[model samples]
Target: MMRPVVYGALAVVLAVGPEMAQTRPKEAASVPAKSLADYSEAMENLAEAASPAVVQILVQRVAPVGQGDSQHMGFVAEQQATGSGVIVDPDGYIVTNAHVVQNARHIDVKILRVDERGQAPHGHLLPAKLVGLDSQVDIAVLKIEGSNLPTLSFLNSDTLRQGRLVMALGSPLGLQNTLTHGVVSATLRQLKPESPMVYIQTDAPINPGNSGGPLLDIEGRIAGINTMIYSESGGNEGIGFAIPANLAKDVYLKLRKDGRVRRGAIGVIPEAITPALAAGLGLDRDSGVILSDVAPHGAADAAGLQPGDVLISIDNKPVREVRDLALTVFQRAPGDELKMVIQRGKEQMTKTVAVLERKNEPNLLEDQASYDAALVRQLGILAVTLDEKVTAILPDLRRLSGVAVAAVPAEYAGLNPGLLAGDVIYEVNTKAIASLDELRAVLNEKKSGDAIVLLVERMGQLIYVTATPE
Candidate 1:
């Protein structure tokens, strides 16, 4: 009935009759067969060329004691974690995910070494210092003391298209210098509504330790920074997301220059024009974005922009959706003028709006915190004394003398008193506490199973929280 197929060194030898072979087209028979060995060699070369730029990141931070049990809460412990990063500069600038080094007291980077034979040996470990971080985009810049290091250049991610071949290089699951190949599944993928940031989606096998790695294009250029994945089982299920290279590069430069990213905003609330909204408003087509409200005395209000104005474009770019306008304004620096084309009540007019610096929120104190010596083990928080420098950032402080919570270590998240970053610790057991030493002294006096009461100011509201230190 059926003949068995035989495999050959170059191609599969299907059993075919003389008649079948005679019926084959001459043009098809004249074509040369490509060898898989060539592709394998190409991939090998690419990996060898790019592996040196991929680094393994080691972090040590304080965290909560227990894994999941509620009884083990209110205790702090130290933990070690591993992630990945890519060297972006010859003088030792590295880029990684901000979450990788969150609350990290110590950070080490392992750089792969390529021998003369083009073979990768064990990586050299070096201490790394955090340059700056932007949590919103989950990007951080680090510096290692070195020069003439191997680095990967960032690709123009806007030119990256769907189905373009790409590779993810990182320490996935603690396996250093690992490389996985895939294609760009999607571009400009927005996971949140009305969010200014977008991601490049890929089908690469990204995992836990792959965070902060580089997603490289076929040419071995950095397409994006591997940030996260969409998985239900905690392991890779093929869907992974990365921060676009353009955005990452912008943040890296800003952080390097100012030690922070200052976002600009024009005070206007934009909403996507839905079919239902258009039907109810009875003004324009059910597409593009509309200004729902303009803040009083804000840049938009001062520029004569009002509610019910449909945004046609901003800075010569079409504003088809809310994110378009949001991203454009978010990328602008304060004092930059935005040339806007708006449609208001059947009349199209141009308006120039000035961008204003958006004030930093209280939660951003974690990014500003650099005091590892301020760790309060009993309270599971890094407390900063409210000096002139700290008080300057916290201008609305009701009282200027209380210690501000700089960060809650990842391990000690569920610890006693339930403290958060930006929270000011004012009193302990009705006794006023002013500095880190005073808070530590108060917390150190308590033993295991002793009840502790903390008076904390959060977002301008004072509240009392009670807990027992383990």
Candidate 2:
């Protein structure tokens, strides 16, 4: 019989004897017992005790407009997707991945039940509703109403150390309550531009339905939430990533309180100080980020940072590159106060900047020196230009305007690294761009050294492309 892994609030220290013991027999006698030490062995204990709290999520999602439904039927087709979730509160607050329950019209949650052999696996199915979802971090909270519901306590994910033993609990490929063991492969991985910007990379085998499942340390503490995988085979190739539980908890609380996560930024376009720029700026080292521009009324503007300023640190963390600044600022909430260190015109200064939330709409930056119009165009295509080899297999995209392929001219070589011309341009940067004028309007404010995020639509697929203008 299969069972859900044990997840609980207080660490259970197994004693040498029956009643007081939470520690396994092999544990060193002098070491203090913390939680369930043998994750694999604790699987059955958690399954037997906490199985009712683990749930199998089934979502019925409405098909999109062009999703190939028979028009004569008069009803859009519904799609079903499966994933795993954990009940986090007795009031029925459940936590899962935002991508898992995205667009779900109906959600069914199945709790585990004990069989005759004393194995607890999937059993009862109940209805649930979305409480809040934060797509940026890929975390979602759900709730089901009932009395005496089982809940799991959140562990301090920040305490997790790299190379520590851990386990992943989820329904991988619909295998309810499956357990896989691994070590903390890596930590603080930045895979997205969004806030709470860190992930716990693990070697644990995670599958499609494993999204939103818990990544538990050996002591049974929730370390992260399994989210994404880097795979070409469309399956786990031993490379999986999870949103660190600390970041997830922060996002969860924000989502629970405000129904959305509000992020803050310094409002200055930043880039890693290259060797050339470092030398041009007369810097001793190329180990800091260069402040490119400060937008009008932007946070950095109010803080008095200038375009030529070299940003060395933020909140005491060295800003060696753009990713460092991005990941640091993204971890902050809107309205949070931040300390920055900058070198400006032969003088070093410190400034306190009140980070501000960026608007959902695009804020164009003016650059009269460059092109006639500095605009961000949304083409809604996720594509890269065909290389000599790829051109043989992919068709050519020409004569499309308003939004078209981004040419890889000398200055634009690294703009859209992974996109090709055949990819349809659906969105210019982040602004929804339907026409060339809209793209132009958005770009009127764009300047050099800005990393533009383009949302592209290609081959009926959507992808985000990050480009920086030279």
Candidate 3:
């Protein structure tokens, strides 16, 4: 009986071992390898189709000698910076970041040429002209001498949702034609409290040289323009930000046509109503936007808008936050009217406010002033006293008397003075300065290399700017 049992166990083991080996091999072979191969091939095809429109940007600009420290005084040097750009029009219109070409004396764009085998082997560099740049939005338009160039079309970024697949293509770390993939982390991200502009946030592994590159969707359309990265070690940490294609497209068209952007505003300070604010102020509702202040004699004031009024809607669209109101006003042109509904106490009322163009933009001020007469070489800025002519073109000022910066001369641009066009200088070293002569007199009193503090009004805000005489 023992011998028969041993023989039976041996037979069972032999049969099961061979069957297990065969079944394991068959399971390992059924991994859907063809599906993975097809997915990779699809990605490769997308990259091949989209790469021709992307370009590497090389810029040479006059920079301060001590590694961009403006305190270096008049001493300056030339520096080269690398970035990326995307062709937007077939006629050679490229979109990039303004910071990429700011103060650039020369700009070269490297365009790639695809071979018959669908691979980019080599490319040519072309000189690009700065058509226009708006630093407020960090968008610039460039023109090259080419016709029927490869281009990318802008996608409706408003349709972009979190978790959507996206791709970032640029010259990261100066490596050209680099592509990184990730998903949208967020939308409508405002980095600053006072800023009206918003950015698209992603985890697309952006690096130093990725700025101004195009962020693409699965279909190879422009979803946004890669602008910045949130990293602690100066490398990609899987967090990046981009300017939405909708805003970029608007700025591009405006800059391409007029070389500047004209933003509109209604003279009221809108603030987001939080739960704490509602409780503190005894508001009727705990959410939505509220009027914190109404500018005296401005459009909102003329429309009978008052502080403490809760904004319900603008132009039939709901105003849920300050961004809602701000964006609506920003998109409107001067003289456009917005029908607004507001809740005040127990009464809800509708009002119409006309949007006013913010004429105090740096470019507009530069255009309106006479450079020869307004040139103030001491501070390297063109100054105009707040006389009637200058006042007529400017927005409401904090003070009626001051010297306004009209432009920064190209000759002294390398000096890197902190002053910008449209800044109204109200005080020099705590002394009131109502005219350019007064400002010049104050500067003349100071010796070269002496530090001076200026109290200036810029974009309806008051701030102090410090600089040394050149």
The most accurate candidate by TM-score is 1
lDDT of 2 by residue, 1-470 (tens): 22323433222443236733545444655454554455445766654454466677988875334324344322234688899988777887788998888657688887775557876353778899787776667888988876678666678876877898777788888888778777888887777554336688898888899898888765556788899899999998888898887778887888778665666777888877778887887877766778778998888899888898888788887777677778777778878988999988778899999988654211111000011121122322222322332222223433133354432222222233566544445565656665545565665567777667777655546678776554
Ten consecutive residues with minimal summed lDDT in candidate 2? 361-370
lDDT of 3 by residue, 1-470 (tens): 99999999988767777779688767766776778788788789888888889999999876546544556644546789999999999999999998898767789999997568877456789999989887778898999998888999999999999999899999998899999899999989988877788899999889999999999999999999999988899999988999999999999998899777777878999888899999999887889999999999888999999999999998888998898888778767688899999999889999999988776555656534444456677788878888775675566889999999987865666543688888899999899998988888888998888998999998889999988875
Tell me how candidate 3 scores on lDDT: 0.86
The segments of candidate 1 whose C-alpha lies over 4 angstroms from its true place after superposition are: 1-18, 21-39, 114-121, 370-380, 387-393, 396-402, 407-421, 425-435, 442-470
Descending-lDDT candidate ranking: 1, 3, 2
lDDT of each: 0.86, 0.67, 0.86
Candidate 3 residues lying further than 4 Å off, grouped into runs, are 1-32, 67-73, 114-121, 280-282, 361-470
- Candidate 3 C-alpha error for residue 447, in Å: 14
lDDT per residue as tens, model 1, 40-115:
7888999989998889999998666775777876555678999999999999999999999977889999997756
- How close to the true structure is residue 234 of candidate 1, measured as C-alpha lDDT? 96
Question: lDDT of model 3 at residue 286?
Answer: 88
